[model samples]
Target: MDQFTINLLFVGASFAIYIGIAIWARAGSTSEFYAAGRGVHPVTNGMATAADWMSAASFLSMAGLIAFVGYDNSAYLMGWTGGYVLLALLLAPYLRKFGKFTVSEFIGDRFYSPTARLVAVICLIICSVTYVIGQMTGVGVAFGRFLEVDNTTGLLIGAVIVFAYAVFGGMKGVTYTQVAQYIVLILAYTIPAIFISLQLTGNPIPGLGLFGTDLASGEPLLQKLDQIVTELGFNQYTAHDGDTLNLVLFTLSLMIGTAGLPHVIMRFFTVPRVADARWSAGWALVFIALLYLTAPAVGAMARLNITQQFWPNGTDAQAVSLEQIETDPAYDWMATWQQTGMLGWEDLNGDGLIQYYNDASPDMQERAAAEGWEGNELNNFNRDILVLANPEIANLPSWVIGLIAAGGLAAALSTAAGLLLAISSAVSHDLMKGQLTPNISEKGELLSARIAMAVAIAVATWLGLNPPGFAAQTVALAFGLAASSIFPVLMMGIFTKVNNKGAVAGMLAGLLLTLLYIFLHKGWFFIPGTNSFTDAEPLLFGIKSTSFGAVGALVNFAVAFAVSKTTTPIPARIEDLVESVRIPRGAGAAAADH
Candidate 1:
């Protein structure tokens, strides 16, 4: 079969499995819908959590970001994965012991204030919604490439599928579906990587092959990649040269944000016990590490492959001729990617050769002038497409290409479903049943959940059709919102005796300040025309928008403490709640009481 047909087959088969599971496991009650009736096994819940947390950003964008930027981007890997350790140690077990269906519920009950809960709900919606927009964009991109549809059409299709499965299965349905998704996405990610690694390094395992000797040059693969990229004026593959302070802060921010994200925290509610929650977090990291460990290898190898393609005979030799690119089947990858409108090239000087060098490099400029090359002609090469283009570039089997297509879509769709679930449950369970209509019937609340999910999907589809900016940047805003607002309040609720007023004040200050800072840098509502600083030149000590989450988190902690000093302390009962949460014994009975 052709690559397109193969891709369709893989994606269609995977989607079929998810929908089938949703049908088999349809949620029927508040417990099932919100927490899967608290019967899910720890290992199963962990796999589900992995699917929910990884999102499109981890699967599609992280490696591409690393490949294009070099070791400076290792912060993403360390930050995302290391955050789970914090989740396990600091948050997951206690939150599960709290025995709540939602993160907001825990806040509201522990703080003895509906206002605090409402603030948490607002934070959850903002963070999850912004994050979902990025996932939706990934869905559209995946569909457009594999199904040959436009982004808008692909987004609408993806949204409808998500609504059908998510509304029907709720957490129960989404959990099982996500377990299947994790499998598809992992297989799809690793197989092609293994092929490419073995081709270059003569080692079977992509992870080990990254450090193994290159088959062609008989030198360490990473060492050769570092030498070649640096010769072309880029950073070494294994070298780290970013701001150490900023790198540490960014990694810490991602960790706190990960532990605090409602969608991820809610996964713990699905398991049956506090001990199970701890085990689930460990398993989730184990599954996540499967991809995280492979990512550095993929990034390093892809960079080496792309750079070597440009400088086949060496940096001093002439670039590959257009005739060679047109005639060679190996170069067909460029033609295929061009059809997606993500890859393009032009010969500005009328030379048949294509130059893929940084135009700003002084030595490269001098060499270009001597060679009579004009301005750079490869006008646009999105960093996001590097992984998607990798299997094609290596000329892997058509089925492998198809599997990757399905895997990328699965990653996007799985996370979008999880986020939409969080949004809908917050609106229906927290806002409607808990606050607006405390007497609302179970069936009515379930209906409300479905309606809210549909509306959320509609909004996400619209935003995805017109994505605000880069995937990584939009996701960073979501993380900043979660880190600054939700994380501190949750921490205070568990670790301190901050009064209701203090918690509420801290949440509002964090949410508003973080949103304002992000808007100043990323435009209000992310519209293109309104911005004061490029992300590169953000306000407040030249911290980029991506790195501002840590600062916002700090601001949240400071404001919460400042407010606590002036207010009446939390009730003694609330202090007991914190102590009760710290221990594992008697948690099951406490949850059962709720």
Candidate 2:
């Protein structure tokens, strides 16, 4: 079959499987919709959580970020993975033991105030909405290329797909569909890496192949990549030239943000017991490790492949001619990606050849003048396209490319479903049912949840068209927002005697401060170029807008503590409640008593 037909078939099959699972497991009551009746086994919930956590950011954009920036982008890997560890180790078991349907619920009860619950709800919605925007961006990119449509059209289609399943299944349907999605995405990710590893380094395992000698050059894979990219006026593939403090802070922000993600937290609420929650967290970590370990290798190898393609004979030799790019089957991926408006090159100087060296590089300036070159012609490479385009870059089989089409969508949709559920649950359960209309029936609440999810999908689809950044960067901003606003509040609510006043104050303070910082650097999302940041100094001085989350967390903790000390202390009953949650023995029974 033709590549497009194969892609359609593979994607259609995956969608059928997802919608079928959603129909079979459609939620009936609030419990089923919100927590799957709290009956999901630890291992099952773990795999589902893995799929939920590994959104388009992880699946489509993480490796791409690493590929171009080299070791400097390792913060994404370490921070996201370590943040999961923090969530699992420090938060999940306690939240599950608390027996709340949403994080906002836990905050309200634990803080002994309905206003605290409302504030928590606001935080959850903001984090979730921001997060879904990133997922939709990935969805748009994946669907755009696979379906041969523009990003706006791709986003609309993806929104419809998500609305069909997510609005129907709620958490119950999303959990099971995510399990199937996990299998598809893992295979989609690793299979290509395995094929490329074997082809380039004579090793089938991509991770091992990374450190192994390249079969073509007989040099260490990273060593050869570094030499080639530097010779092409790019930095060494393994060098870390970014500010140390900012990288540390950015990694910390991602970790903190992971701790507060309501969708991932909601997964724990599906398991039956606190012990099961811990076990699921462990299993999710194991599943996540598979993608995490493979990512570095995928980035390095793909970078090497593209660099070699541009300088076929070597960096010292003549650049590939435009005529070859037009007629060569090997360059078909470029044409395909160009249709998405993501990958493009312009012949600025009317040269028959397209030289892709960094024209702005001081070392390349003399060479550019010597060759009468205007500048770099390959000017429009979006980092987010690297992974989805990887199979094509290596000229893999049509089936492999087809598998990726399905896998990338699975990655985006799974997380999007989970986030939309979180957003809907916050609106229906926390806002409408819990606070506004306490007498609402389960049936009414369920309908409200579906309606809320549909609305969220519409908003996310619109935002995806003009995303603040690349898939992963947009996600990092969400994380920073969550980290600043949500993580600190949850930690204090569980571990400290912070009063309701303190909790509300901390959330508002952190959120506003972080948002201001992001607005200054990111030009407040849609207006892209208004920000002062540039490629030479990506951060302000040394810090990025994304790195400010850790600072926000510190401010939150300080403000909450300060306000709590001055205000009325937690009543004796609330103190007892905090004590009960902390104690392990009879923790499950304590949850029941509450």
User: Top TM-score: which candidate number?
Assistant: 1
Candidate 1 residue-pair clash tally: 0
Q: List the residue pairs that clash in candidate 1.
A: none
Using Cα atoms with residue i matched to residue i, what is each candidate's TM-score against the true structure?
A: 0.98, 0.97
Q: Over 4 Å off in model 1, which ranges?
A: none
The C-alpha local distance difference test score for the whole of candidate 1 amounts to 0.86
Clashing residue pairs in candidate 2, if any? none
Error of 1 at 519 (Å): 1.0
lDDT of 1 by residue, 228-276 (tens): 8777766666788777767777777787788778999999988888889
Error of 1 at 334 (Å): 0.9
Worst 10 residues of 1 by lDDT: 229-238
- Compared with the true structure, model 2 gives a TM-score of 0.97
**Model 2 stretches with alpha carbons more than 4 Å out:** 529-541, 585-594
lDDT of 2 by residue, 258-343 (tens): 98889988899888888888889989989988999999999999999998998898998888889999999999999988888888
* Per-residue lDDT of 124 in model 2: 88
Candidate 2 at 278: error in angstroms? 1.2
